[model samples]
Target chain A: MILFELIAPIVVMFALSFLHADRVRALLALSAFAIMLPAVQLLLQDKPFPLLGDYLIADRLNTYVLLLASVVGAGVALALMTLQRHVQVHPRAYFRFYRFFALFWVGLEMAILSNHMGLYWIGLEMATLSTVYMIKTNATRAAHKEAWNYMIVGAIAISLILFGIILIYAGAKPVLGEEAMYFTALLGAADRIPSPFLFEMGFAIVTVGMFVKMGFFPMNLWLANVERASFYPVAALFSGILESAIMVGFFRFSDVAKIVNFSHLAGFIFVYALLTMFVVAFLIYRAKDFMRLFSLSGIEHMALIALFWTSGGTFAALLHFGAHAFIKPALFLSTGVLESQGRYHIAGALRGYRGLKGKLFWFVVGLLMLAIVSLPPSPMFFSELYGFGSMIALAKSGHHLPAMIAAIVLLLFLLSIIFYRFVELYQSMKYEGEAVEKRVYGSELAALLLFAVGALALLLPFSLAFLRSIA
Target chain B: MSAFLTGAFLATLVAALFATRLYRLLMWYALNSLALGLLALLIGSGLNDPALIISGVLTLLLKAGVIPLVLKRLTQRFALTRQVTPDIKVHYAVVLIPAILVFTFYLAEPIGRMVGGNANSVAVAISSLFLALLLMMEHRNVAPKIIGFLMMENALFLLGTTATGGMPMLVELGIFFDLLIAIVVINLLFRREEAVE
Candidate 1:
């Protein structure tokens, strides 16, 4: 099943590459369903399934991430299908998009499933390469430049990650022998790894690398720019799926750090997350473009998720990840809908429209934004509540108390400002003009509804229990 | 022999930082890659490891031979400006390079103690990494940056071989595959950059 999950995307990519563009679109829906099936099966498995002598494993954490990537991959494909109906994209470009999109999914799934650190690095490198073109396809000078920067930064980050992995292997070699390459082997021998300092250094270096990859503060330069430059569907996948997979990879490393009793590691990530969230909140408030706004919003959500996980609120962290995974794409795709109508600013997104379509658009966009701000009853609301609750518990245990208090205060302050900004935008979205019935494509609406419903459904007892089970 | 090759590897990379001419930089990169390949081969034979031997041969053929040649063809085809101008001045680089090397030497000291390998070789691997990063940062040209990236990979490969005797064969193969894909992407990006300029 794991093999099929890994192979199906590549098969789809090759098949689409050979098909004509018109035919490719029809097959993409079926292709997405095919690619998602194995992932669904993996996600449903009660026991861990180790494959290929433990080089790949469908453990609970990774399987959940795999499901996220597969669902978002299919969602992005469906959204793009709707985009094709409204826009006049060249046939060759359309065909090329699906080809690379499939490749991106392959890389992401491979990275998530790999138990060997070296193979994990390789998978991420593949994903990074595919992402460069996804942005560059925008065909603007700024887009090209942003893609170029993304590649350079990504390449550098990946190299550093490799260096860190080698260092870890170096540290582990004396203790675990050849078994050191496998994550579980290293974890099993964590206390016996001979060189705790080297292990810690490697973890630090890997954290720095992931800070860049996951868009943490001080190394998040390329993220919003790249996301803003990409086509919205690609942006959706970038935020919704790719970032989640990378976080899962980092989490796997941190699990080792935890077992090895690197107490400072959690604090480092916590401070980093708090700083990222606070800074990105202001950036979101000041953002002029809707794409940039949501991109900054993604940084904030990822920071919050990191905070939750590192504070020992693993359940809240995973819950927040699911919430962001579902809602962020919906928000970005909502912007895509508005973008098609020449609305790129939050202020006037609904100014000219009227009647039921406008009302529905306003409601959907508003609900998603409300969820972004973690309004009551939203999944984000519960996640943030439990996340902060865990964080305060950690603080009372005397871990970086001053920094934690300041961060919590700063977070609440900045969050209110963000809430004010969203409310201001919601007010601006009120259209008092004459009714001009705007017909949105069914696929686009369906795509938005799909993710929005997914986000909302997380509030259900079943989803909550499932999330707790995974945690 | 590994010591001499490691020294040569670091030396060529340091020289590449000062190579003002594009072809000269590529030549320096080729030499650096050649030293890495030879070091891998030497280490592999000493350990009697077939995987490392194969990795060494591939590194030589691909990094030293094919990639540089492909890059040369790309530069000629694009008619990109051959004269290289780095944003950082040479004198500052001259002072800073040794500083970076010294810092990493200290950085690798504890790990070296733990591994009980030649501490100098670990120091050299890390210094080479810093020099490679400098090579990337000091250049404004796309070609140099790409070369720096490849050199970065070579330095990492050297570190793995030196530090761990070699990763699993599967990982080595995957790394090689990723490098090939990266070069293809680099080739395309170089073309696009040239076209844009």
Candidate 2:
């Protein structure tokens, strides 16, 4: 019975998907927020919310993620409305669009909530499949190629995850049998699970597979490719919400690793995090499109957040993730406004407008860009400051070499190259071109302002007692 | 018995690697799935595990039986060329396959010890995984690549059965369900809208 209730949103989504009416889709999304609230509330009360079959259990770790994902959905819906105002979405395309939208969220929600690793694998794979259509929303040749690339890589990564799952399950067979595959049970008996080395090795593979799902470093080619070709809202979905969800999933693995050979797992994560941050930060200067630039910078921050996770900066990391969640979508939505103008280059896009109205529009863009770079007063500023502190502390504690490489060396490169390139882009903007300055769509402005306010609000210290000790 | 089952499984993968005819590739998959089912059955009998037997039954019926039929019908509908156009030359693939199998045998030693299973079986399964990846990479068309994916899943199933005796029944059910969905999605994706046949 509890299982049925847990799947009720998916049921509702499938039923509503056929409607294709704006009102029905809005209602469907709002209802998702409604259903997710109880789970979040359950976590807030410090109570375990377990489904009947033990397929899913809600803990504090996932509660924050659930709340953020729910909000990202609503925010993206709002942004989509803003996009719809300019681009003529065919009435016929509505059903498929909304169906994929529903499928993406349902799969994501399921992934976040799944307790069984196999169930989680299914959920993430389902979400990946759904996103293929969303990425192909534009239907251009480039869109097809990007979506195809994304699908191929995502499938390969998921296959790797499957192999990892089998290995770990097999490793646990002697001590725990099949129950060894359940995360809660496995974590409880991590030390007792036979062949601890096998478990660790399998988990290492799973962790790497997940990184391929979420980031572009080492395999750093696809994130910008997919985002640059996708419609902005789809870009926002994958970049802001979906990737964050995967991070939270990885966080759970990290959380469980406290019981499973913690030092090795922590060290492994740290190396990857710093490596990704350094490589992507240098590559940020090479971003061709403005959207790709935003994505590359987001990757840098993602690496930083992963770094925070590894360095035991739990609060600062979650804070950074939360700040990024708000700032990224808003940035994407606003950028959608510019990209929707059918221009190729940032200079060309900027050249399509003129006058005071254009300046106001550019102001909005600048605000988002500044917020993303963690410029002062933006909550990212504080979150990032805390991250720096955490890294410094980590360096002082004896692992000075890697920490210094991440904190000082790559940090210098990031600021000089990425941020400076951003400034160069800022200076290149022109308010004089072919198209006239247009009034900001109300929904677009509303979403942007909501994001701006959310970014500011993230600065206010939410006393998360749970994360206090982890630091 | 396990060695024979694993060997037959690996042979099917090797056969698929060299098979040019599209129908022959599907046959290799069917034969591969059949070997995996038989392997599961053998393990189930040896361990007296009903869940393994149940998984064997499912694999035999759905993967070995139903899926190959579906692929056949799909080929007929698409009117595709009978032969697979692998990007890699045949002679090169033959060399790569054996090299991969040898490398994985070395690679599987540590993992095999950890599981305390039939080391050769585990080694064979691991090698099949890489070989399956090669098959997937070799294909430019969607069908062969998906067949390659299905083959990879078969390899994992063999690993699970041999290493763990068997995974939990619920996880197996979920895995099979996911495979069903994957096949449907792959078909739909290839067919585009208004799927024929």
Residues A128-170 of candidate 2: C-alpha lDDT, one tens digit per residue: 8888877766656676767667777787778777778877877
- Candidate 2 docks at the CAPRI level of medium
Model 2 spans with C-alpha error above 4 angstroms: A1-9, A21-25, A32-36, A348-362, A399-407, A430-435, A463-471, B193-197
DockQ of each model vs. true complex: 0.72, 0.51
* Alpha-carbon shift of residue A430 in model 2 (angstroms): 6.0
| lDDT of each residue in A1-471, candidate 1, tens digit only | 568666865687758766765766868766876777887777766657875668888888887777777777777777787675555556666677777777787787778888889888888888988888777666667778787788888898888888889888988888788888888898788878788888888888787887788677876546878877767887898888878877887888887887776577776786677778777777778877778878877888888887788788888999899989988888888776565555454445655546555566667777887888888878988998898999889888975778777888888898888888877766665543333334566576777777888788878898788788876
**Residue-level error in angstroms, candidate 1, position A74:** 1.5
Error of 1 at A196 (Å): 1.2
The candidate scoring highest on TM-score is 1
What's model 2's interface RMSD, roughly to a tenth of an angstrom? Answer: 2.8
